[model samples]
Target: MSAKLTFLGHSGFLIDDGATTLAIDPFLTGNPKATMSAEEVRCQFIALTHGHADHMGDALAIARRNDANVIAAFEICNYFEEKGHGNVNPGNPGGRIDTEFGWVALTQAFHSSSFEGRYMGMPCGVVAHIGDKTIYHLGDTTIFRDLELIGEIYRPDLVLVPIGDRFTMGPELATRAAEMIGAPRAVPIHYDTWAPIEQDPAQFAPQGVEVEVMQPGDTLQLD
Candidate 1:
């Protein structure tokens, strides 16, 4: 089976495998680059990487409207539950949450997680398996050596890397990270949203890999 992966801008994505659809970090409400609104998103599941406003944007709204399951760190799930969304699948770094399509695993990320002065949980990178393809969304983080090991373990066909500076790895380091992961293909994310994180995608070139610079609403087919 093949999956259609749509880039929802600024680290957000929609992955659909025909039977099930997932929204990862669906931050569209305040996204200047987002072409679709929160109400336009349709998914059976919502998987979040952290609790930042941009990353967690419109998750609850979309989930509640669609009655979708929320997947994220344990604290994030608890947070949502407190907000009245009871259907959640919680996991933490080094843990995996099973889903109908496949599974969602959280990996360590060098970043912080919080929302409205509350400690959400450890920030994480998500590895999701849908159909026969695997996707690694490296949330928000600085370049780390473990990415190579992560690549070896999951061997994802595609990887989503953050190239924005100040908050995460810049273009130069992100290129190294993509090379380290050694995925056949990679997509640049979490950049060009704000002036602080502005970047040129052309600066991100990983050897032996195809770098796809996706714009808002761009979709890719993974088989």
Candidate 2:
């Protein structure tokens, strides 16, 4: 089986493996760079890496509308459950949630996780395995050496890197992260969506890795 990954701007992505569709960090509602509306988002599962507003954008509404299973950290899932969304799978760093499509695993991320002053659990990078392909979505975080270990274990086909500075790694650091992960291909995210984090995608260059700078709504086919 094959899968299609569509960039939803920032760190959001829609991965569809023909039968199941999964949404990751879907922050489309108020996202200026988003090409699609929340109502247009259709998925059977939604995975969130953190509780930041931008990262959890429209997840509640989208999950309710689609009756999608929400996969996130323990605190995040509890929050959704309290709001009446019962279909939730909660896991923390070093934990993996099994699903029909395959599985979703959480990895430690060097960042904070909170929304409206409430602690939302640890921020994390998402490693998703679907359609016989693995995708590593490195949620908002600074450069860390453990990325190399993650790459060796999951062997992701594609890696989503954050090059938006201030809150996350800039192009220079992200470039090194790409090298450490050693993924064959990577996509730059978490930038160009706002002024504070604005960055030139071309600046991210990692040796021996192919970087695909995708615009919002751009789709990449993965085998």
Candidate 3:
């Protein structure tokens, strides 16, 4: 089955697999490059990588509007639940949860997780299997050695990585990471949205790798 992946600027994305649609890091309200609003997103599931505002922005609003389940770490889900947004699937790194569309596995990420000074949970890398395709979204983190292991385990067709410096891996590191993961295709995110992470994404060319730099609201279809 073919899947439609829409870039929502920054680290946000909309993944549609015909039967089920997932909104990941739907942080658009304050996003200057956001092409769509929170109310416009139609999805059955919302997957979060961590608790940072840039990644978790507008999650509650979109999930509440679509009545979608928010899948993330235990504390993150519990935080959403306390806010009165039900249907949160809480899981931790190394475990997989079968969903209505497919399955999601949480992997380890080297980062911090917190919202308003409240501990959200350990940061994570989300591995999603939808429409018979696997995608690895390495949430905001540095390039770690385990990515090679993650590649061996999931063998994702596409990998979404951060190319912003200071907060996450920059172009060179990201390029090396893509090679380590051995994904056939890669997309750059979490940069150029703010001054702290400003970057020229064109420099993110990975050696011997296909790196796709999608504009905000651009869609990539894979069969």
Candidate 4:
């Protein structure tokens, strides 16, 4: 009854708390490692950290077909609504939205926010609380000092981070990020999508942090 976390490749994740199903960043359709297509994905809620195409991939299509609520930044939410999906809950950094399972807090993430040439400002990460477990997904960002502040505030059980270079923090910075966030367990994502961002998880795994290198369609149970 705690929560189950599933990695859907390249910043995509599916979370189920037994009561509610939530998908984060449905970048599955075009991803080589992705297991489910846009039409095949099922969820009650979809959480987006930014407006980038890769992160927002197939979200609209999936949300529309599944009739799921989409959670994202204000501008991104409006954009999705304009696209004809009105079930969007606009959130900002430091804001919280109540879901069927529990509350999901919008946290700060240092990244650009734009989708299809449109400037959708205010990208953010999500701190979701379901049952007794709290999870933090860092979105696409670099290593920042305020991560210690976020860790102090949420005290997450599991942390999902991007280890892809060129756009996000690679293994070196991700190692520092893991230390800053102070999460019990950390998983690396957003890598190997293309060249210039390829990385080996073994090189990133260090002491004191339970580093889980999850493949596409892999499931991790949090109890």
Q: Tell me each candidate's TM-score.
A: 0.99, 0.99, 0.98, 0.97
Of the candidates numbered 1 and 2, which has the greater lDDT value?
2
Tens digits of per-residue lDDT for model 3, 67-131: 89999999999998999997899999999999978899999999999999999999999999998
Please provide the root mean square deviation of candidate 1 (C-alpha atoms, Å): 0.7
lDDT by residue for model 2 (1-223), tens: 9889999989999999999999999999899999999999999999999999999999999999999999999999999999999999999999988999999999999999998898999999999999999999999999988999999999999999999999999999999999999999999999989899999999999999999999999999998
Residue pairs with colliding backbones in model 4 are none
**Clashes, model 2:** 0
Output the worst ten-in-a-row residue range by lDDT, candidate 4: 200-209
Q: In terms of lDDT, which candidate is strongest?
A: 2
What's model 3's lDDT at 116? 94
| lDDT string, candidate 1, 1-223, tens digits | 9899999999999999999999999999889999999999999999999999999999999999999999999999999999999999999988888889999999989999999999999999999999779999999999999999999999999999999989999999999999999899999999999999999999999999998889999999998
- As a TM-score, model 3 comes out at 0.98
Of 2 and 3, the candidate ahead on TM-score is: 2
Q: 125 in model 2: Cα distance from truth in Å?
A: 0.5
Better of 1 and 3 by TM-score: 1
State the displacement of the C-alpha of residue 196, model 4, in Å, after optimal TM-score superposition.
2.1
Model 4 CA deviation exceeding 4 Å by range: none
RMSD of 3: 0.8
Model 1 residue runs over 4 Å out of place are none
Stronger candidate by TM-score (3 vs 4): 3
Ranking by TM-score: 2, 1, 3, 4
